[model samples]
Structure formats: structure tokens, C-alpha cells
Target: MATSTPYSAPLDNEKFLYKLVIQLLIFCQGSHRLLEPHLLAIGAKLRSGANSQELLSELQAVSKTLVHISKQAKQDVNVGEGDGAALQNNYLLERLDELLNDAEVPLRFQHQTSLLKQRVRANLSEDSYKKVIDSAITLLLNIKDYSVSEQKGIDVFLGDLSDRLDELGQDVEIAGQANREMIDNRENLNTEIHRQVGSLKDSTQAAEELDILKNQTAEYLDRLLEQLLEHKQIEDERQRDAQEKIELMTKKLQELETETETLRVKLKIEHDKALSDSLTGLPNRLAYNNRAEMELKRWKRYRAPLSLIIWDIDFFKRINDTYGHKSGDKTLALVAQLLLNNCRETDFVARYGGEEFVMLMPNTHAFQALEMAENTRKMIQSCGFNSNGENVNLTISCGISDFNESDLHDDVFVRADQALYQSKQNGRNRCTVFAA
Candidate 1:
């Protein structure tokens, strides 16, 4: 029966078992597409009507192959089981957190976004993730609306400012021209009065000398009196016109002053905003540049000891990647506050740019600045940072350089930066002073 099985399955049981095995293989192949290739090979062998032993051997081979594949699938799934999954999730969440941080919004929306970003975590539950995503979407929409409204407001403000400035300029020009014309008219009136007075004196002397000329003198005096009266009327009209023009000019000047005051206030606000860092509320790079230039000038004039310290947050990017950008911002603000609090009132501290800060210490030598920087580093290292209820230890590196007799403004910065690089290249969380 076994030998004849290929040509004719003699027993009904054999034929039934064969049909059952074929159907089972078909069902498994359909269910598990991964096993299709192995199953297809087995199916081909079975269709050739091989003997029982050959079929059994082929079945065992396919079963072994399937088992190996199943193990590999489990391993693949387990690859993201622990820290790997958290890292992957944090990668995406950090990106979202960065977007939230970079968005410009009103204070209210900013607060909302800050809260939302704080909730970002590497190991978020599905529900928590969805909630955060929905909140982010809502915050983004609100920010967009606010931006549109703010842009319109800015446009209107600029238009009003421009119009006021133009009006002020025109008023000043008109006032100046009116003053010039008034001065010229006054001079000409004085000249005409002097000439008329001289002519009247000469007529009086002639009238007293010749009685024959008395009638002519009387007619001339009457004509001179009429001319004097006309001149007086003209002077009165000129005085009225000058008074009116003075009042008009005074009102225009008052308006101009008011407009100029308004523009000054607006410009001051804009200037402050431009020089301030929105993130940490510290002076920005522009402010830093201005301060540095002023300090350099002072150093040159007085030969005062002026030291520059460049501070960089160690592993700042890692903080953002591991925790979130919100945490990174918080860290920056905290560090800024620390630096501000520790520095002298006369010292200038500014946020140079992301994760870096510059400090100008007037009347301080490089050694003194280095000491201060070391203390700051130690303070930062000891300070505890909590993100998502977890403690994150932070550290900072600093480089110090002071102005020398021959050093340019940029030379100090370059030396400090190089020193900072050295501090980083060496073990971080320390301070290094430039040698030269």
C-alpha cells in the first residue's frame, strides 16, 4: 500500500488524510504570509505523491524553518522593549517640543504651549500621547489666530507712526519758513520807518526856513502824515498776521512734540524687544554686541580690567533629546537667573545664542573671572533639574579672557571661545582661562 500510494492511494483513510493535510497547509499559508515560501515548497513535494517518509521529512524541515522565523519575529518585536522604545518615542516628541518652543504666540498661548510641552515624555501612554497631540493642535491654531491679529495691529501702528512723522516734518518746515519771512518783513519795515522819519525831519527844517514854502510844506506834511497813517495800518495788519502765525506755529509745535514723544515711546519699546531674548528674558546677541563695544571703549580709555567669560551648557542637546525642549528652555532660564544673581550689578550678562551666554566683567582680571566662572560651574552642577518628576543633573563649561594692551575686541572673544572649546574637549563642567 505504501509503494502504490504515489499511483493510487489504495485506502480511503490515506486519501482522506492526504486531502486534510493539503487543506491544512493551504489554510496556514493563507494565515501566515511569511510562511508562504516554505509552505509552497512543501506543497509542491506533497503534490508529487512522495512516500510517507519523504513527506514526513519535508514536514519536519518546514516546521523547523517556521519555528526559526517565529523566533526572529519575537526578537524583532522585543528590540524596542525597553530603552530603545523610549528613545524612539522621545525622538519624535522632542521634535514636537521644538516646534512648540519655536512658535511665536501671545502670553496666554505661550503659557498653554509651555504646559503642553511640559507633558511631553519618552514613555507616554497612548491616551496621554493623544491628549498631548490634541492640545498641541489647539495651541497651534490659537497661535496662528493671534499672529494674524498681531500682524494687523503692527501694520496699523506703523501706518499711524509714518503719518505722524510726515506731519511733524511738514509742520517744522512750515514753522521755520514762517519765522524766516517774519524776520525779513520786520527788517524791511524798520528800514522804511527810518527813511520816512529822516524825510519828515528835513521837511520840518525847510518849512521853518521859508514862509513862501509854507503851503508846499503843509501839503507835503499832509501827504507825509497820510503815508505815515497808511504805514501804521500796514504795521498793525502785519502784527495781527504775525500773532496768528505765531499761535498756529505754537500749536503745530505742541502737536509735533506730542507726536515725537509718542514715536519715541514706541521706538523704545521696539528697541527693547529687539535687544531682549524672548526665551530667558536676558539681553540678546545684539545687546551683547553693544555692551561689549561700550566696555571695549571704556577699557581703552581707562585701561580698566575687562574680562569676558563664555559659558556653554554641557550636553544641552542631550537634555532636549532625552527630556524635551521645554526642559531645555527651563534649564536655560534657570542658568541665566543663576548667572544674573551671582554677577556684580555692573557686570553685563547676555544670552549670546542657544545654550551659550556671554558675560562682560568690568574691573575684573582673567583670574578673578575664572574664579567666578568656576563658582558658577559648581553651582550649576550642584543645582538639581527636575523634568517630568525626574531629577536631571546639569553642568556647564566656561572660558575666560580679559582685555590686553594689544588685544582687539574680537580677539578676546576668539580666545575665550577657544578656551571654551578646550574645556569641552577636556572633561566638561569646568572653566578654562586663556593663556595669552
Candidate 2:
């Protein structure tokens, strides 16, 4: 007899699981469909080649993050519908906010985006979030895509380079052909002289006949000399032409090489600019990510003390709202200067986003980072920012976290961010360290 099967048999459980998975998948698909318009509208903003690449990269990251959240929610079957949805949407919007950061966006769109970011962070319903998303898309659509023109400039440079290379190759080929022609001319001249000499014989003859032969021989010798002279002149002319061609090619090649180098340097400068925050003149989020990864690797390999400090200007939005963006910018610049002044040579400081700044401290533990952060905070607090003829005292909130062997760089960052959130919650102007 077959063993009695339990009510929750493996097949039955599998069937239930399959249905649940399907439902989750359907829900995710439907949700993506709903947001597709917003995504497309945002994509429309990235019409320029220069901005499109970074924007698309961020979009891809955000999409992956959303997918991950959706899958995680799918696994947790017990999560309530409203709570799960709100959680997923909140996380999605937050991740998007980070990905579609205003600091990274074009300057023309920054003002609109800065305001949108505030609304995105506000306590709003999912519907309100959707409205904010739509507004963001609309604003992005209105901005002109300048990257297209920038890309055209790059194309023109590349085209000129290619044309120069082709001209150089042709010049080289012509010079070689000219050289070979000169060599062949000399060889032919030598062969003709040799044949003319070999034709003479040593035999006794009458004086008159011998004189006639001498005359003929003299005439032939004169003709040969003239021919040799003509060949020499031709060869000289060819050689001169070839030398000139070679010299021209060399000069052109040098010019092309110099131009290529200039273009490369220009591209590098542009890349650096793209990775930098214009307002603060500090390395931006993209640069921070790269450096953070490298620092994390070093810590993992060497077991060195690595600490992260995240700080934000206290009431920065208020500063913006009160004194105008220019004043806000001045304040940010002041804070950036303070941070740079306080940091050690080994410490890497970067503008993480909007008002936030990050410092990666190698060979420093959490306590050390905390001390450094406190100093920075105090210095910023004491700095008097005279913005729009108003005296503004600035302060910052900081969060400090240290690296663990088991944690990824992102893990460490999340912990630091959490500590920052706690600091903000406790009060705006203080430093907090991650406990766990």
C-alpha cells in the first residue's frame, strides 16, 4: 500500500507556490506597464548623446533595483497588500531619486528637479508620487538636449583625424614609389655604361680606321656621359621631390599626433567635468562610487581600518528657500571648502548628492572618522556665510560607519546612510555612529 499522503503534499504545495509566483509576476508586469509612460517621458529628456548614456545607465540600475524589490516582496507571502505595495513603491521612488539625482542632471533641469526631489521625499500617497513622477517627466521633456551637438563635435574631430591619417598614408606610399624609381634609374644607367664598354675590342688595325673607331668611341662616350648626366639630374629631382614629400608627411603627422593628443586631453577634461559637481567643484556621486569600490577592495585585502562619513548641510533646503539658489550654492561651496580643509591627504572627500558629502577614510576607524566628522561639523557651523547680505550660520549632520570584512561597500554605505537618518531624526546638527 502507498503511504498516506499529507493534505499539504509536495505536489499541492508546489501548485500553490506556482500560482503565487504567477500572481506576483503578473502584478509586477502590470505595475511596470503603468509606469512605462513615465519612463518613456524621462527617456525623452535624454535626447542628447552626452546625457543619454549616463541617464540610461541610471535607469537600468533603477529598473534592476525595482525588480529586486518586487521579487523580495513576492517571497514574503505574509506581507499585507497595502504595506507591501507602499513599501515597494517607496523603495522604488527612493532608489529612482538616487539614480535620477539632480546633481548629475544637466544644469538647465536642476532647478525643476530640485523642487521635484523635495516632493518625492515628502510624505505623499502613491498617487501623489505618480504625479511628481509625471511632472518630472514633463520638465525633462521641455529641456533641450545639448549632448547631440556635443556628440557632433566629437564626430567632426574623429572625421578630421581619419582624413589626416589617409593623407599621411598616401604621402608615405608616394614617397616610397619615388624612392624606388630613383633606384631603378641608377641601375639602368650603370647597365648601359657596362654594355658600351664591353663592346670595345683590342685588335691591330690601320691608323685611319683606328682613328674612325676612336671618334665613334668618343661620340658614344659623350652620348653616354650626357645620358648619365640627364639620369643623374632626373634622379636628383626625384630624390628632392621624395624628400619634400617625406618632410611634409612628417610635419603633418606631427600635427595630427599633437591634435590627437589635444583631443584626448580635452575628452579627459570633459569626462572629469561630467563626474564632478559643478556647484561644489567636488567629485560627484559617480566618482565617489568608483573610489569607494577601490577603497573597499583595499580594506578587504589588507584588513585595514576603513571608515565612511556621510554628512549633509542642516536645513539646506531651508537655506535654498530663504536666500535663493545662488546663496544656497555659496553655502554649499563654503561647506565643501571646510570639508576639504579638514580632511587628511589620504582621506577622499566627495559631494555625494545635493547637500550631502561623503568622506572615505582609509586607515581610520569609526572613532577616528567620528572625530574628523565632528571637527568638520563644527568648522562648518562656525563659518559665517554672508548670503544675499544676510548672515547665515551653517551646521551639518554626520553619520560614521566602519567597514567589516563580511560587508560589501554598498552594505557599509547603507549602514552609514542609516546612521545619518538616525542623526536627522534625533536632531539636525550632530554626528551619529552606526551601532551594528
Candidate 3:
């Protein structure tokens, strides 16, 4: 006899057809414009059923939602409202993106999925979606490759999520058990109370016969000691059960605390991963943009002076060519640290890009921004960076721009860039200010 293999599921055909359809719906916002024909073909393969109808309806609904999502995405790009609406939209997109891994899934029918992803993008690019999916998948699979402490922290957290669900189940069971126990106790108490009353009544009735009651009362008093001994034994058993529960509770609490410490450590690592540059360990460009925008808003709200200084090392490419790329990287790192050390707590600094640094100076005017820039220049000049026996001091050009009534956050960048160009023309290592 031939053996037939048991069927298992991959994200592709092996999984329920619904998974593929749901993914398409989420990605395209259900737009059938591109994938409608393909969906129809999939429907034809299914024997007529209620499930097929549901799939068809979902696909139709997604098309409508995609239209709305597209409009919203465009609106956010140019919106000046500064409300939480953009953030909310971002979260919605993130939820949808997470559902599909932002279009990272290769549809078994790539022709259909590719067409759908192309048509349904509000701001979703295939490359970006691919990047996010690639990154997350890579991170997930390789997370175990991290240091033991780090991996342990992750294990504890993932375990905690599952544990919480199990705990919820256990709590439900315990609650039901408690309810039953309470009912049983109530019934026992009522029965015991009735039995004791009956005994008292019998004793009273007997007491009416004074001579017989006297002998009976003495006998009943003797039996009371024996009954008390039985009650003591029952009480001891109850105490033991309570003691066991208390010990189990203590162990659970200790495990929870250990999990908490591990989580704190894991969170710190993820935070740095998200906010800092992977290569240089300085703040990344995305962090710089977000921070600068926040600073601009704060300055606008309070009518405070805020200046942005955009600086780039002079002849950076020459250095890279003269020394290897490794030497160039160390120089950049060295310059980043030097600039960082020279800035104040109030000042925000970041590596904007290759050989470029941007700083946000709160409550600072053009003159003050210039002074800070000059100080940064001196710091870099003072320290000779040594990497692989190549020693070099750095010179940089800086452009300063300040916020005014007409300036928006995006414009702040442009103005700063202009000033940086002017500073380069004036002389390297000098600071120049842009006039609105």
C-alpha cells in the first residue's frame, strides 16, 4: 500500500484560502481594480458556497477602504493642522502594514499580489514594504543570535504574554471553583445549624423529665469534648490547603519579578535599536527629523528662539579616498562624539547623513547658533582621530537658520542647507546664517 503524506500549511497554498484573500484585502484596502480578475478566477475554483460569497464581499469592501486610505495618506503629507490625526492615521497604517507585513508576502500568484500592491498604495512603496518585511523577518529569526542575557529577556517576555493568557484561563477556572465551594459551604452551614438546633431541642424536651434529663445532660457534656476533637481535625485540613495556595502564590510573584527585570533590559535594547544609527551608534536621520520637528513645534508654541545648524566636514570624500572607508568611518564617529560633547543638555544633535551633523538649539538666536557651531569646529580640530595608524584633525562648514513667522519645520531644513552652502563658499570651518 502507498503512504499518503499528511497535509501541512505554509503561508501559501497550504494555508486556508482565506489567509491569502485577507492579505490581498488588507494590502489593497480591498481594491479589486487590479486583482479583481484574479479573485474571480480563485472564486471559480471554489465549488459554489457561502464562504466564497463572503470572500467576494470582503474584496469589494476593501476597494472602498483603499480609496479612503489613499486620500488620507495624501492629506497627511501636506497637512499643517498639527493635530493627532496624522499620528492616528499612522497607527492605522501601521496596523494594516503589520497585518500584511506591509506587503512583504510573496503571493503564490505574484502577478496578482504585485498588481494589487501597486494599485492600492497610499504612500506604501513596494521597496519600503519589502524593507520592513525583510527587516522584521530577519529580526525575528535571528533574535536568538543575540547575547544570552538579551535572548533570555526576549524569552521571558514572549513567555510572559503566553503566561498571562494561561493565567486568565486559570483565573476563570478558580472563580468557578470558588463559586461552587461557596455554594457548598452555604448548604453545609445551613444543614449544620439545623442539626445543632435539633439536638438542642431534643435536649430541652428531655429536660422536661427532670430526673432523666439530669443524667442525659451529663452524658451530652461528655460527648462535646469528642465533637470538639473532630472539628479541630477539619480545621487543620483547611489550614493546610490555604498554606499550599499561599506558597504557590509566592513562587508566581518571584517569577513575575524576574520577568519584569528581563523586560526592562530588553526594552532598552529595542529603544536604542529604533532611535540610534545602526552603523555609527549616533542618532539616525529619522530620529533627527522627528526631534527637529518636535523642537520646532515647541518653539512656535512658546514664541521661543530656535536655531538649526547644519554642518558638514570639508573635503570628506578626499579623506575617504586617501584613507580607506574604515578610516573615514572612524573620522565621522570621532567628529560625532566631539560635537556631542561640546553641546549642552538643552541642545539636540544628530548625524543627519554622511559627514553631516545637524543641531537644534533651543532659545538660541543666530549669533548663539554661530557660537555653538564654532565651538563644535574647535572640538573636532583639537582632537586628532587615530584609526589604523591614520591620524587626522577635521574642519567643517556650518549654516545656521532660525524660525520666523513664515517658517515651517520642513522649510527649516531647506534654509539651513542654504546657509551651509554659503558657509562652504565663505571658507571651510566658518559659520554663516541664512536670511529669510
Candidate 4:
């Protein structure tokens, strides 16, 4: 150690060190060329330093920067700037898995997704990227088409509802006007009756006056007798007129009563139409809402067990597509009748919407409701529906929920709907009861 002083080394060792440093500088320059855009500052630092410690530090910093860039590139990309903006890689994978598993998705689409998913799993190359983009675009286009179709159906329903409401309003206005006219007629008849009564009373008073005159002044009896005779004639004429008026008023009152009855019938018809589904001839959503409110009040007051069941026709859209809309309508009507037949007198059934029915069972628990739903399901399954001379098997799914303490009307409905979804998920033609 004493022989080799502080900065002194063998000539061979010095040459090897110089060669090694030169080789390191060449390697760093090549790396700078490859990564200059990302590592500008680090490259500059590395190039500006020559001391061993300084060089070692710069190399370490460059390695860390490269590592960080690699990790960041592998993370989720910001797809947009608002809600659901982050395009998580794991989420995409999960969605692909779901698409593959979901039987509802078309087999062709599922097949495409399955192939692409496998390729993506193997290698995220340019080919895989293109495939993913193309598949996503196709799927989105289909979704848009389906959404447009659904919106069209909704628009049509709303238009029909508006028309019905307008008709109902016109009927109500007419009824009100008829009522006002009836009131006026009644008032007029009363006035006429009072006038006739007063006339008869005046005639009687005049007759009594004539009698008094005959008893007090016998000398003017001849004149009084003539006047009395003329008065009698006038009184008879007045009586005839009053009798005619009374008869006319009685006929008018009868007519008014008849008109009133007719109006009552018309209003009842309109009310029924407003609260019922025209196609299925079952109570509609409005009726359901009213009934639910009443039932909720009853449950609150009496602590009665109230159960709700939500039923849906399985593959209803398929029926419409395969047979026709007319067949779909027929199916809905048949199902409604079936439900009505099976339901108890106290149970309220309504058509919630297209292919959906709601049942409100008073004083029934969830288990009883479930049993009833199962029976209904079996009935529908065995109904042996036919369309176009081909046997079309119809089935229904049901969900049941009972009223709980502190439960609102909508809460029960939501739970029932959730259970219905579970039934559909588990398999069609089955019933599920909500536990809570």
C-alpha cells in the first residue's frame, strides 16, 4: 500500500480503466440517443459528469426514470375528462370476461370477444389493439341501435297516453257543462212551481173575499155573482195553465234525471279506462299506485302483513319478434286473465308495464306470496300457448316481498323488483322471495 501512493497506479491498470470508461461513455451516448425525448435532463447530467461517484449517481437516476416510465405506461389511461373517465385495464378485462359469460349477448358477438380476449391476454400487440377497437365500435353501434328502438317505443307509448288524457279531459269538461245545464233547468223548474203555487193561493183568497162580500152586502149580490162567475172562469183558466206547467216541469225533471244517469255511466267508463290497461284489460300503473298507497296506509294502521309480487313474462320480446305484435298483445291478455283467475278476491293485480305485472296481497306473508307465485308460474308454463300453428311455450318469472316496519311503498316495490331480477338471473319461469 505504501508503494502505490494516493493517485498512482500501474500502467496496465490505468489503460484498462481508461478503456472501460470510454466503453461506458459510448454505451451512455447510445442510450441517450434511444431515450433522449424522455430522459433529457438525466442524459445531460450523465454527459456532464466524469467522476466515478457522479457517474454512478446519474446512472442510478436514469434507471429509476426508465423504470417509472415503464410502470406508468402499463397503468390505466385517462380516457376522458369527466365521469367514468379512467379506462382501467383491469376493468376492461373484467368486462370482457362478463361478455363471454353472459348468455344474453349474441353468440357471434361473444365469440368475437372470446377470441379477442384470448389474443389480448397472450400479447397486447398492434393486431390485438385493432381487434379491440373494432369490436368495441361494433358493440357500441349495436347498443345505439337498441337504444333508439327503445326510445321509439317509449315515444309511441307517451303519445298514446297523451291522446287518452286529452280524450278524458274533453269528456270531463262535457260532463261538467251538462251538470251546469241540469242545475239551471232545476232552478227554472223550481221557480215555475213556486209561481203556480202562488197563483193557486191568490185564487183561494179572492174566492174567500167574494164569499165575505156576499154575506155582508146582499144588495150588490147580482153584481158580485157576475164578477164571481168571471173570476171562476179566470181561475179555471189559471189552473189549467198551472197544470200544464207542472206537467212540463215533471217531464223536464225526468229528462234531466235520465241525462244525469247517462253522464254518470259515461264518467264511470272513462274512469275505468283511465285506470286500466286497454290491451290486457287489467289495472294499470296508475291503479297500482293508488292501491299501493291505500295498502301502505292500512299496513301502517293495522300492522297487517302485506306482500307484493312482481311478475314478468320471460322472452316476451322474442314472442313479439317471432310471432307478431298482435300475438304479443294476445299473450299479455291471456297472462293477465290467468293472474286474475288465480288471485284471491282480496289480492290486487295490475299491469305494471309492458310484460310486467304487479300483485298486492293483503294480510299475506312473503312465503305465501312466493307459493302463489310459483303456482302461477307453473300455470303459465303449462298454458300451452300457440302462435301460427306452432306451439309457443310461455313462462313467467316472479319476485315477492312483504311489507316491513318503516317500509315505504316504493321500498317494497324496489325489493320486489330486485327479487324479480334475481329470478330472471337464476333462470326464467321461477320465483324468488326477498329476505328483507
Candidate 5:
């Protein structure tokens, strides 16, 4: 494939990528930039199309989640749907973590996104969302590098993602299933109630017949009083038996509920921390490794397209050296903030270490990753530093690499690191794809 665009114009693949991304974001139904970092990490390791598709589907799912949440939120009328609010909030955290996340994404962006999510949640209308989606499509169609083939590819990707979204769209199917189950249970309950009522009616009729017989037995007055006493005793025994049955059902129900609660809490804790990058609020190392492993396995199984990017701060030691540790810390934080700001929710951004950032992009190829790496490189270059009252200009060198099942994360790292070294040698503040 040709790497360069037409001579007269500069092609922006990132913008091209984002146009679809924006539309998909809108398509995700107003879920608010919720993305999963682990999926990108996994995409890097894809050795099969199946794995790549799986990761792509995951990314698509994030978009679907946004829509689902938006619809659910608009439907929520109560002032405080406590648990609902928490779930929505958790979803928001997970979603925002994807887009506005990095080892050093700015506090300002975080603040802005946090505020916007709240507002968006408050009154997200389909019409407003439609406007955003229309604009997103327009912006995408206008990009200079958007060739017919590229545009077609994007549309195809969108189709695939849409298909996956549609598959997930049946998320309501589970609810419907539960409702059906409830209906069945109601039917069973009604049947049991009727059976009990029938039995009670039969018993009542038998008692009434006995009472009439006794009332007509004037010659056997003693026998009539004795039968009435026996009837009262039978009623007491029936009430006692009914109470015992209720107690047994209550105990069994409570036990089952406690067990379910325990399992849910345990599962949720593992899931929440597993995919999170605590220090930077990006995807954690565990998530990255697991995702990469999963994607690689999938790639090996299905032969799908995938790629990786390793970009770190240039001369990071000097920043710590010249600016002191606090400034260094600030710089790292700032850089993390930058990565978070620039990336899509589906893009994974994690701090590799003291001054390095890595991204795992599943649906994108090497060239696209390179373009993105360049944009990041330039952004960091232009992103002048800030401390008490001083300003410092900075630059970053980046490296790009693609991978497969035969390729280990370590090998990919080596290639990208070498590429990064080349970028540095070539004069920092640029991107280099692995030549070897």
C-alpha cells in the first residue's frame, strides 16, 4: 500500500480515524467517551482476525454501553436512583477513563469531562445527539487524507462495529428473559394459590355440612357440642402448618440471596481493579498484559490485523534533573494528561514507567499508529511545561511497531524501543516506525 498521500496535500489519518470515532461515539448513544484500555492492549497482541475482531467488538461494546446508559438515564425519573446513579456513575468513570485518561492527562480536561458527563447525563436528548452525530460525519468526510478506499474501509469497520453493536443491542433481551421468568413464576404462584384456595373451599364445605348435620341433631346435643370443638382444633393446626411453610421459604430465599451477593461483590472488585491504572488513571499493567495476551491468542486463532505504539517522553531524566522531582512529577502528570486528551475511548493509554507511555490499537494498522504517534510527538513538543511561574518547552521521540502471535510483548517492546532510539538519534520530537 502507498504510505504517502498526494503531493499537494497533507493527509491526516488521525482526523480520518477520529471522524468515524466521533460518529461511533455519538452512535454509542451518548454514553460519554467510555472506553476500555485493556482492549487496545489486547489488540497489540492479536495473532488472529478472530482476536482482532473480538477486541473490535469490545470497543464497539463500549460505545453501545454509552447508548444504553443514556437511554436508561433519560428514563430514570426519580431524584435519586441511588443504585442506578452509582451504576451510571461507575459507567461514567469507566467510560471517561478511556478518552480522558493517560499517565498525565491534564486536571483541566478531567474537570471539563467530569462536568460535561454530568450535564450530558442530566438531559441527553436524541435530537441533540443527532446533531453531534451529523457534525461528526461531516467532519470525517471532509478530512484531506480520506481516500475512497480509506473511507470505504472506515465505513466497513463501522459496519462491523455496528453489527456487533446490534448483537449487543439485545442487551434488553436478558431483561426480557428475566421478565419472562418472573411471568412464569407468577403463573406458578397463581396455580399454587388456586390449589390452596380449592383445598380450603373443600374443607370449608365439609365443615359446613358437618355443622348442619350437628345443628339438626337435637336428640344428640352432647355430640353436637363435641363436633364443634373438634372443628376449632383442626383450624388451629392448619394455621400452624401454614406459618411453618412460610418460615421455611423465607429462610431458603435469604440464604440464596446472601450467596449471590457475596459472589457479585467478589467478581466486581476483581473486574474493577484489573483493568485500571491507578497512578495515572489509565489502564493498569495487568490489564495491558492480559489484553495483549488475549488479543494475541485471538490473532493466532483468526489472523486479524493489529498494531502497537510505544512512545515515551524524551530526555525525561533532564526534566527531573533541571526542574526537580516535583517538576518532573508535574511533567509526567502533564504528559499523561496529554495522552488522555488526545486518544479515543477505545485507544489504550498506559504509563510504561517513570516517563514512557504505550498504546495498543486493535483496528488500526502500522501506518495509522505511526500517524497517531507523530501527532502525539508534536503535541508533547508544543506542550510547553509549567511550574510555579516558569515555562519550559519540551519534545518527545516516539517509536511504532506491529505484531502477531510469534511476536511477544517483549519483542514488540524491543522493536519500538529501537525505533524510539532512532527517533531520538534523528533529532527528538519525531516518530519512527520499526525498520528492522
Candidate 6:
């Protein structure tokens, strides 16, 4: 008999089909125009177990429309493109772009896109409206080859694979049953032998019968004792084999645990490295971006105060030119340490890029933030570094901007940057607050 391999199912074919369709639609959004909301609408219906044929027909119509609009879009515009027809068409296209962009987020999709689409239909000329619908349909139909041909192949493969797995599972079950039956037979034989030995012992209690059968009984008893000794030796060997297997498994488990710990430590180190500035040992720009966004959200929710401070080393390029890059690096690191030491735990400081750093101060107003920046500037000016036995001193300029009701995360940073430019313009080593 041939041995069969054990099998487990991969992803279900139906589930895979649905996911593939969704991915195709998402991909189309980047390449094609006006397809996202229509695809999204179809996707919603498909998931609700709606009729596939009906949905496919709807998609086909949309695909045709998309192809028509795309062809029109690809045509060269006339030299005098500011014609009323062109302007109206461009305005319509802009709104459609917004609809598809907003449809990327699922929760905001229906309400935003539906309302926008309605507004667009009301404002657009009849010809422009037709073009939009046609363009959307064409983009969706482009996936027909994947959804139809490839999907059929996958379904057949999964069906055949599932059948083979069922057959193998049945074979394993039957073999297990046969092994159990053999063990049961052996147990029954042992019980019969015990019963016969007990009967013979009872017969031996009669003296005349004992004398007649003594030699035969002694021969039979010796053979039985020898058989019992062989069985005991077999059991002893089995126990030794089991003990070896247990020891091997225990050693393997310990090895696995050690490997897991090593991997965990390596992962943690990599995670920290990704977010850290190697030279200054401060959070890098990428880390700063994430922290600022979260802080902005918190400020918006509670209407609490938030402020940003931007810092730059005064005449940093001149220092790098005079002392070489290594000395410049030492100065940057020194300034980073000074700011870190002066800030509270709640504040976040990050190296924004080359000789520049940003501090995000929560619950700090404009004036308060300026005070902190001034203190940092004074400390940096007084701080000295011993680089190659040369006493090196550093000074920094800072800019402060506080969060307001109208402020976005980027707005706060931009204002602080403008103030920093002003400080650099006025003099080298002073803090400047943003005027607006």
C-alpha cells in the first residue's frame, strides 16, 4: 500500500475571490479615474450575498462607460483650452477626483461620495456627466480577465485539493481503527491464559491427580514462566525507548525558548534604531512626525494648549568649515544634550535634520514656550566641549509658536520655522517668538 501525506486546507476559494476583487479595485484607484465609489458600491452589494450575475452586469455597464471617458481624456486639448466647454469639463473632473480620493477611507465613503456625486450631477452639463459615468465603468471592466478567468482556475484547484485531503483523512482513520483492533485481540488472549492458569492451580490441590500430572504440570509451568520473562524484557526495552524520546523533546523545547528570546531582543533593538537619530541620540524626524500628530489630536479633542520650538546652531556651517565635520558633530551632540536636560519628561525633543531640532511642548503657551527656548539657548551658549584638547563653546537660536484653534499640526511647525528664520536674521544666538 502507498503512504499518503497529511493535508490541511489553505484559504477558502470564495474568501480569496472576494479579497482579490477588493485589491484590484484599490489598485485601479491609483491608475484610473472615477472608479473607486462605483467599485465600492459593488463591493458592498457583493458582500451582502447579492446576485453575482446582476452585479457583473452592472459592473460591465460601468466598465464600458469608463473606456469611453478614458479615450476622451487621452485626446489632446485644443491650444485655446480655456473655452467654456473645457472649463466646465475640468470643474466636473475635479469633483470626481475628490469623490474617488475620499472613497479610499471606508467609513467616510458612502456619506461623502454620495452627497458629492449628487451635487456634481446637478451642476455638470449633460455631456460631461455622461463622460464621468462612462470613465468609471471602463476602469471596472478592466478587471474582467482576473475575476473571471483566474477565479475559475482557482476554484477548480481548491475543489480537487479538498477532495484529495478528504480521502487521505479517511485512510488515516481506518488505519487507526485496525491498530486498535489488534491491541484488543492481544488483551483478550492474555485474559484467557490467566483463566487457564488459575484452573490448573485449583486442580493441583487434589493429591492423587497431582501425582499423576506433576511432571507435566512442572514442564508447563516452566514454559509459562519463560514466556512471562521474555514479555517483561520487551516491556523494559519499550520503557527505555520512551524515556529517550522524552529527553530529546525536552532538550528541543529549551533550544526553541533560547532562540525565541534572542529574536525578541534583536527585534526590540531594530525598532529603537528605526526611530532614533544615530548621531545625537534623540528621536529622529520620522518619530517626531508621529508624536506631533498624536499630540495635535489630543490638543484638538480637549482644547488644551500645545506649542512648538524650532532650534538651529548659530553659524553651524562656519563651524563645520573651521573645525572640520567631526568637531561640528560634537557641537551638535552637545546642543542636543543641553536641550534634553532642560526639558520635562512630558516634552518631546527631536533632531529635525542637520544642526536643527524641534521641541513639542504640551500645555505650554507662546510666552512660556519662548521662556523655555531662551533658557535652552543660554545653557547651550555656556556649555563647552573638549574636542581634541580644544575648548569649544556653542550657541543656538530658537523660534517659538503656540497652537491656536485654527492651527493644524503643520501650521504650528511652519510658524515656528518662520520665527526661527527671523531669529537668524536679527542676530545669531537669540530666541524669537512668531508674530502671527
lDDT of 6: 0.71
Candidate 1 residue 199 C-alpha distance from true site, Å: 7.7
Candidate 6 weakest lDDT stretch, 10 residues: 101-110
Candidate 5 per-residue lDDT over residues 1-436, each given as its tens digit = 2555463243364345435544654444433434444334434434333333455666666657667767766766554565676567546543433333322223323454344434433333546544433543443344323445545765675586566445444534544554565566556555655665565555556665776654444424444445546544654554465456556545655764675576568557646654665456666666778777877776677776667777778787677557654576567777888888987777777776556778877777778888877787788888886767778777777788888558877888788889888988988888888886
Cα error, candidate 2, residue 203 (Å): 8.6
By summed lDDT, which 10 consecutive residues of candidate 1 come out lowest? Answer: 98-107
Residue pairs whose backbone atoms clash in candidate 1: none
Candidate 6 Cα errors over 4 Å, as ranges: 1-246, 300-303, 384-393
Identify the runs in model 1 with alpha carbons over 4 angstroms from their true place: 1-67, 70-89, 92-213, 278-280, 289-307, 312-334, 352-356, 362-366, 377-436
1-436 per-residue lDDT for model 1 (tens digits): 7877775745666677678768869678776666677677768878788655667776777688779878987987887585586676667777786565444446566667657766974457867877887888887887778768767876886797678667767766766776676677667666766776677667777665576457666665676677668766766776676677668767866876886688678767757866887788889888999998888888999998999999999999988778876688889999999999889999999988778899999999999999888888888899967898999889999999999988898999999999999999999998999985
How many pairs collide in each candidate, listed in order?
A: 0, 0, 4, 0, 22, 9
The C-alpha lDDT values of all candidates are 0.80, 0.78, 0.67, 0.71, 0.62, 0.71
lDDT for model 2 comes to: 0.78
When 1 and 2 are scored with lDDT, the better candidate is: 1
Q: Is candidate 1 or candidate 3 better by TM-score?
A: 1
Give the Å error, residue 369, model 5: 0.8
TM-score of 2: 0.62
Model 4 over residues 1-436: C-alpha lDDT tens digits?
8866655656566556546655655565655444554345444644675445555555566677678756665563332332252235534644553343221233234465556545544434446656775776677577558657656865775586566556656655655565565566556555655655565555556655777644444534444455557655655665565566556556655765675576568557757766877667788888999999999999999998999999999998788668765577688899999999999999999988778899999999999888888888899899957888988889999999999989998888899999999999997789999865
- Global local distance difference test of model 5: 0.62
TM-score of each: 0.58, 0.62, 0.56, 0.50, 0.44, 0.45
* Deviation in Å, model 2, residue 420 alpha carbon: 2.1
Model 2 sits at a Cα RMSD from the real structure of 21.4
